[model samples]
Target: MTSAKALLLLLILVNQQLLTADAELISLTTGAIGAGAVGAFSAIFGTYSYIKCKFNECCDDNWIPGNVAHKLQQEVDEKLYGQHIAQETVIRAVRAHVSKLKPSKALVMSFHGWTGSGKNFVAKMIAKSVFKKEMLSKYVHLFVATLHFPHPEEVEKYKEQLRSWIHGNLTLCDRSLFIFDEMDKMPYQLSIFLFLSNGGMNAIVEKTLENYHSGQSREAITYKEMEQLIKNSAFNEGEGGLKTSRLISRHLIDYFVPFLPLERRHVIMCFKDYLRSRGFPTNADEIEELASQLHFFPKSSPIYSVSGCKQVEQKVDFLYSDYVHEHYKKHFIDDL
Candidate 1:
């Protein structure tokens, strides 16, 4: 019947759509798989033209293409930096962060900053291009930046399992970098993180002494302890979190609360619009001086404004947005 033929055609179309979506998902996760027998299959798909099945060629589609992994490799190889500052900066970062490291052991460098500053995009490009090349791969061990969560309710891990992970890298016996992308969001930057990322053990020195209080815990943390803490504090949901049947809860903010340093407080104010609301300091001070120095911060706006910590805590959207709009307007708006 004509009706039966139409139904069959519709079903076939639906199946093809599902297959396409499945393929996309696999591409997105190719960089996150474990290597084993299954990993062997992944490698074949990623690197080899298995369809050239040697003597065992068959009707099977062994010549299937790889996902984003393949595409990324091609992009890195084909990328031609045409006298752009961003490309130069990326190359500088690669040279400064990787090439300069001592060949004694593997190193890591966490490029911490706000979101949408192209951390992952830039990181992937560097790893795929610099580390995969024959000359650098011979001595400079490179890797994709890894993220670890520390406690419950947070996404990254603590210092618990970090040591063993580093110990595993010991066998490679070459200087390398394990870059951490976001450090300000973490409870505190671990010492080992600096050691692994920076190549030198003492790279964990404070960039600003103002952050440390007189009586803060000064004991150094070990890699194992950090990793163990991460493993213990896992998130668990017990039957839709018990909030007594008819109970209600509301969160409140304290006005003009005094905490943290005066400079830090001002930074938050400038960030949230509170500074503009309070008619931001007309008498120029150190904050303005430093803002100009930091590339991460935007160029001073004629119409400067800010908000409170409560409004934009853990969300550096404005800063990242301002930076992206200035530099990568066309690419920034595209759907990732």
Candidate 2:
């Protein structure tokens, strides 16, 4: 037991302690690396799952899609000129329905009015404003009754097909909009038609031979019949009632908006709007002069446009062209 022996023992203990420390450090470093590897693997797997779900049917493209209420309000306020009440009602109804937690029913609106009134225009506006891609959305369906159901004998078949179409679309997406135009011309049975009124190449037109007395009639359903038909199609509770149309009963009719005939003032406003959209000057004098040229019913009838701006754009085009020609004559050509 000398000093040298004691020193050697101390050195051995020191070396053993250093070895233990190195082993502990290595263990800690390995644990950290293992945890980092697990995290990396988890991140890669999560990203792949996300991409797959996005590409597949797991994610709906239009789930809680656009701010429909705001867009509708904006569209109506900006685009629709002389229908304040109609515009307001459309915005309110659309916003309310879209705001619901789970809207069990579709908003059914009936637009009725004279031929050239803004019924179809407003209907299309509603559809476009509600969806992100507007009318192009897969959920929006436009059906013109006169275009869809020409043959009266095929009414029942149209009914079944309509029902199936509605069911199928709703199944795919509950937020679908089915817009039926030309309700005034619809058959009493609430079915479908082929639109022959367009005068297009594909449209069906009635012609009478001088030798033959037989021809297709263009008789429209009376207003009373139209009312009954609408009630039967939209409000009936079940398919078993006296009113057997389940399409309307199954879906809720949110509003029945009637487009009243446009007065001369409304027509003037439409003219101004059209002018502004076309980047033309819409001064009071110009609108009045243009309005005077439009033909109204009852030769003395307060100068109202019965066609409700139907011919305004074309008339404007003609007027503008004349104006341009006159300007050239007054300035460039006359100077020469």
Candidate 3:
């Protein structure tokens, strides 16, 4: 080959190599630039998914589950209103539901009324009798939100925060319960009224953690609120931190609800005691006398309970036909 021809071939080869390098660089650049968007996408999607799943059905919107509602209904049937029998029934049913490998939403069953009517004491008794691990394990993964003294502002703040966290962090679950005690105090609570009535609403647990953990804000929820949150949201659905929580929260609840199945999760809530506690009784009743009449003991003076349909039918019949609206609005309506 002549020198000129050889030089021409070398030039052609160098040009080919340059072209290859340019193509490779372009590919790398494209990939690099796309990485952040891809990550951001995954992060946002993950966060959204996490939020929806983690809190989709949280606390049955922070109220009693169907099973609990069912039991409460039964109590009402038996005229067990103004009694913790309804709550006890809920505990038993919750336990039954959990034992079946079924998990439930976290909820706050606000026990309210005139101060001193033994509502709180009744709640405690109801918890003891119905919320035993053995009972709740069967159906529910319990979460309790007992307010020490939830003022209206505090209630709204927590509710807004909770809704934000759920939207940003939580996911839907088949079943959970959030028992909000003293909701009457926080007249502006979300998901609570709907809960007792068995309706759907939203809450967000992820934003709650993010605002809290990143020092963007304090873990603003106080000890009482936190305890209730932990208890209610005992079955958290994420690895940790804001990002992961956001990613997994929504899907977590969604994932759980399907496998768990709510067909069997009928619930009810009951109101038996007409007051808060003996010391805080409604009306001008003598403390000791009112407490005595209220049956502060586990076993009632009448021995056998107002058993079965007779008791239930009577109470419900009256509430539904007689004065159900007034009953809830006036008698059972929590003072918060």
Candidate 4:
């Protein structure tokens, strides 16, 4: 029998013998036998527990330890494009929070930027760093505002359900991660309950321009400056769910991360990366052609991508579909 089965069987046998000995215990021989049975049972139970925890997701073994900060930094550097400020802020925040033995409260960060500027991408990276199964892990919960709370009128109902869901998940695993996407679409009432959003797009763009015009490098923008701008924007912006929300009023958010608009060069990098990931040719000319297909903003300067890398995968797939079909026909259909 396998070791687990063997151990289980041995445990059952030992329990039965101990019970029988207990019923007639009095003699020294019986006492000695009972003591030995107890010892064996304890050892077998310990061994079984160790095996179960090691091979199963029943314990801390399934969670990534604090050392994952280093891995997260490396992955962000290699994979994530643009948003230098976000890269540094996230790495530092996560490293500091995870390293703490007893954090006073949950680490809450608000990512702000225009659509497709890597807000969700960074969240996924954080999830991957902390959970073995990454975004698919039971500990990771993703709730899209539009999908989960469609009715703004039923804000109270959604709040209760959301609260219960978070509590239930936390009970199951204290390390649970709850990601709320499209926070701008969520009802303002629900803002106080969760921790996520995309706000301050205009302010971010304006600040970036101001810095550039002032002869300052974009990379020199500090977290403090970006944080203040994002906070002000979220507070004053009517469309954002976080406007006047208790989370911001009470200073509950730990960091307000800004994802700068992706420039043409960054979008090109994204195209090449996607192509390489899908086993497609990373030809410089072809990649440039693919990137040129994307729409850039500010008709005058035409610097940043209008859609960022959001549509990159779709564009790449569409570009290759016909080629793939013809290649299949040539290699497989011709042989038939």
Q: State the displacement of the C-alpha of residue 155, model 3, in Å, after optimal TM-score superposition.
A: 6.8
TM-score preference between candidates 1 and 2, better one: 2
Give lDDT tens digits, candidate 4, residues 1-336: 433344445655644543333422222233245556566657767886677667655427555455668888988998888799999988998888777766778887778887789988888888888878788877778888889898888978998897787787777667767787876654311111224565688899888877877998889999888988887786577755567566666877788889998888889888988898988898888888888899987787787888989989998999999887888889997798
Q: What are the per-residue Cα lDDT tens digits for candidate 3 across 273-335?
A: 322321222333332232222212113222112221113223334433534466557755576
Candidate topping TM-score: 4
TM-score, cand. 4: 0.81
TM-score sort, best first: 4, 2, 1, 3
> Candidate 3's C-alpha lDDT?
0.32
What are the root-mean-square deviations of the candidates from the true structure over C-alphas? 19.4, 18.6, 24.5, 7.1
Worst 10 residues of 3 by lDDT: 256-265
Q: Write the per-residue lDDT of candidate 1 for residues 28-109, one digit (tens) a residue.
A: 2334434443554446444433533433322222321113234444543344211122233334433443333243323233
Return the TM-score for candidate 1, rounded to 2 decimals.
0.26
The count of residue-pair clashes in candidate 3 stands at: 114
> Which structure among the candidates has the greatest lDDT?
4
Candidate 1 lDDT score at position 118: 30
lDDT of 4 at 74: 84
Tell me the number of clashing residue pairs for each predicted model.
35, 10, 114, 0
Candidate 4: worst-modelled 10 consecutive residues by lDDT = 186-195
RMSD of 3: 24.5
Candidate 4, lDDT over the whole model? 0.76
